[model samples]
Target chain A: MAKKRGRADIRERFGFAVKARREELGLTQEDLAAAARIHRTYLSDVERGTRNLSLVNVERLAAALDLSLAALFGRVDAGADGA
Target chain B: MAKKRGRADIRERFGFAVKARREELGLTQEDLAAAARIHRTYLSDVERGTRNLSLVNVERLAAALDLSLAALFGRVDAGADGA
Candidate 1:
């Protein structure tokens, strides 16, 4: 049976990806949030891997970073985050 | 300027995608939820486009459906779901 994940590590990896990309673009969290048109706190939480976001929200964040959804999550393996 | 979305359309699209894949596998909502280790209602909600799930949940769903996150969302366009 496929294992259900606890989610901490995967969320952290996602957050790290977002943060790394943001830094590469020289955008602050607020700037990214503003560009993404989301609340700064929400972006912050996402960056901290503390928030579980929807695809739409993830899409928004990827756009704010000027990246594609695939590119944004290019590092993930299918089962790495899921059970 | 990019538009910030209200989320209804995007969520609907995502739900449609999930449902299509699930049906392709011939799994019922209860079966899918059980395989995903989530509640049947939650699966129903997601399939109905009524839920705004977190990344972890999305990951779980994709895993249950035997899909990669990218493969699961292969039809999306950037900025279509974001501002």
Candidate 2:
């Protein structure tokens, strides 16, 4: 059978990356949200992998965390499985 | 002033990368969208950077393009500017 439309793995993995990075910097979700110019609830959802993120939002989070887009994605890659 | 919420740069850069890679494989937008199991119109928007990408969708595109998430994102990183 084909996989489901909405991807849970991506959410969990991406959210994990965000949460890990946030914790590393000792920044709260609210703080990161403010820095990224997004809502705190959205950030919370993102960290839980319950939200789908636009590339722009990813960029915002990356900027707020002082990471390059590459670096943010690097973390996601680390947890992924593919050829 | 803070930057805009919607990032055209991510869209354009990401879309450019997807388009370039798709072309490198000689796949049309329809072909790619079919392979990715996403709609052709959605793929077009993605290629134009007019659509936001969830991690799942990004994964789908990467799968269809025979790229790892890292590789796909590597292209996005290439065109981005951050501290």
Candidate 3:
């Protein structure tokens, strides 16, 4: 059996991606939430590495941002924060 | 600020999506990891809702499974376990 990685790590990585994209597009967390149909606070959590998003939410964000899922996860270099 | 959703929730939802896709395609977590160039343990964690994936790894898994990210996050009904 394979050992599992913790959810926190994944969430943090995802948050970083979202924050970068949000900045690259010149949107605040609030703006992203409005465009993505998600709550601004939730977007903030996602950006701060404190929250994980649902598939539905992910789709909403991606659609709102006009990005592919692959693009959402793109450019994982440390210090690549755009927002 | 909108309330941030917990990372556990996001990881769980993403895992559910991955498990459903893995089963739909008749592939094991190990198989998925291999195809995606990820670790079996990490894939297992992802499947079990225990792990959050890096964007790089998510892309690898998506490509390995031949699924779009939208498809990966599809159909979010409870009791829909495929794996």
Candidate 4:
């Protein structure tokens, strides 16, 4: 049997990353959304793992978070050491 | 009123990138799936705008395709003179 991957998994991962970055920058979803020219409700949805943002919006959010696209997509390892 | 962004859009873009890279390497989906240690059916879905791959799997696929994660995620622009 093949393993299943779902949109919820992707959304959760993306939400975790976004929330981590937002907290690091001391910004709320509203602040980040404003900076990214996106709606606060959508940003809230994204942060709550209820949304799947597009690549362009992801890029915009990365810009708002002051992170490179590569860094934004990079997963946190179990090493537990901050990079 | 806000804009709608769906999983399909993301999947389609990802598929386009994967197809472009696979063709560039002159490899079939089956070959690419084998190289990436993934199922051909899943790979086909990923390349047909129906799958949302995980970060780890995306990295694996990029490596199998001999591409960096950054290159794999970077969007192609309308100014298509070839990069």
Candidate 5:
């Protein structure tokens, strides 16, 4: 994980946090996308760490996950620490 | 401040954080923009809460401010609480 961290950009880190939370809430991509009011494919791209999404979309995802923006990024920071 | 929070979008909140941090560090817009390798006008737009910037650029600002993404978002969250 430490070795992988070097290669994982912030987008990937953020995506991992989103995916982790979604799975924790027992949501599929489609379900989460609907909740966030974003396209499923866009959500898929976000989860794949391929999308450089803006803050508006990021906030939507956070709201959908019932996480504050700070909490969401806290997950990202935790992941950076290999937690 | 509480009154302002209701009307302030996330972008505006984020801009406030950037401006606050830049001020704390005694850096002008030009200085921070140069550090972030972003255009001064773009940074200005961000500071004005008008730019819905992507994560890549967000990271740049965080780096320039010597903050982690989590820390930056923490400031945003703080602002939401009228802090």
Candidate 6:
């Protein structure tokens, strides 16, 4: 039986994906924050999985990261089962 | 050159994916709304692409539709270029 994943799990997975992508792109948090037009602290919060971001913000991040929405979520799904 | 997609486009595509999945399940708007614990009117707004929904609500809808988050987003990405 599969365990039900909660909101926190989802958020954390998303955060991990974002952080990984940022690192892969050699982007500092400030760089991504500026590109996404979000505050650095807000980006920090998102990276920490404390922010319950909406679709618009998610899109903003995806655009800043040069990723499609599916690609971004694909990372989240990849890490779902094990991490 | 790729045309930049606006937030409205993303929301609309996501909404279309949701609507399509809901229909594939032979579910009414009310049924999906109840299953996702959202108001029918809110679901209507979501279907219309007027609401910038949060991740929690998106997850709720995904769970209600029996789709993993990646699967749900795959639908959105599948329709991205053509529709």
- Tell me the whole-model lDDT of each prediction, alpha carbons only: 0.75, 0.81, 0.63, 0.68, 0.87, 0.86
Indicate which candidate wins on TM-score. Answer: 5
Tens digit of per-residue lDDT, candidate 4, span A1-83: 12233223546667777888899899978888999999999988887768756556775777788865556766322111222
Model 5, stretches more than 4 Å misplaced? A1-7, A81-83, B1-7, B81-83
Task: Please write out the lDDT profile of model 5 over residues B37-81, one tens digit for every residue.
Answer: 999999999999999999889988988999878899999988875
Q: TM-score for all predictions?
A: 0.78, 0.83, 0.48, 0.54, 0.89, 0.88
Clashing pairs in 6: none
DockQ of 3: 0.10
TM-score of 4: 0.54
Cα error, candidate 5, residue A64 (Å): 0.6
What's model 6's lDDT at A5?
Answer: 46
* lDDT tens digits, residue span B1-83, model 3: 12233223556767887788789999977788888887888788887878656555664676677865445544322323332
Which run of 10 residues does model 4 chain B get worst, by summed lDDT? B74-83
* Model 6 alpha-carbon drift over 4 Å, by segment: A1-8, B1-8, B81-83
Colliding residue pairs in candidate 2: B11-B49
Question: Which is the winner by DockQ between candidate 4 and candidate 5?
Answer: 5
DockQ of each: 0.46, 0.52, 0.10, 0.15, 0.55, 0.62
**Ten-residue region with minimum lDDT total, candidate 4 chain A:** A74-83
- Of candidates 4 and 1, the better by DockQ: 1
Residue A11, model 1, lDDT: 76
lDDT of 3 at B55: 51
| Candidate topping DockQ | 6
Scored against the true structure, residue B64 in model 4 reaches a CA lDDT of 89
- Report candidate 3's interface RMSD in Å: 8.1
Score chain A of each prediction against the true chain A by TM-score and list the results. Answer: 0.79, 0.84, 0.74, 0.79, 0.88, 0.90
Error of 5 at A17 (Å): 0.9
A best-first ranking of the candidates according to their TM-score comes to: 5, 6, 2, 1, 4, 3
Best by lDDT: 5
Chain A (candidate 3) TM-score to true chain A: 0.74
Report lDDT (Cα) of residue B28, candidate 4: 95
